[model samples]
Target: MGEPQNPGRERGLDIILASRAYDLGFMSDWGGAGNIISTLYSAKSTNFASTWAKIETKARTELANELALFRGLE
Candidate 1:
């Protein structure tokens, strides 16, 4: 028995990437500040796309954890 993984981590990474992208310039704070208001004032947000492609984020995070455990995060 153990704690389930926090899927919010994936969204957090997405927000970080999105914040830096050209489509979301106004939405700074690295996703810490969330709202359509903050996100709306963008330079050009017509095609706002996230960099962290879902499964990739999960795989990367899981792989990171496994690697850490192998190196003794166990």
Candidate 2:
């Protein structure tokens, strides 16, 4: 039998990407969650997973850097 796989990883990634995209204002001013979702859907492609991973890494790094700066101000 094959090994069982972790199912949440994909869902987790989807949530992360959607949240990050929303945070980054990847939507029109008049649009809302639906627009964000549509934008993400339109961005889907064979390389999208790789692109999303890169974006996630960059966001993590930026957030960590911001936190460090904030801590320094204390």
TM-score for each predicted model, relative to the true structure: 0.27, 0.35
lDDT of 1: 0.49
lDDT of 1 by residue, 16-54 (tens): 988874533223322322233434455444333442232
Report the C-alpha lDDT of model 2 over 1-68, residue by residue, as the tens digit. 88689799889999988886344333322223224345567777556445555456555566676668
Model 1 RMSD in Å is 17.2
* CA-lDDT, candidates in order: 0.49, 0.56
* Most TM-score-accurate candidate: 2
Q: Model 1, 26: alpha-carbon shift in Å? A: 40
The residue-level lDDT of candidate 1 at 47 comes to 30
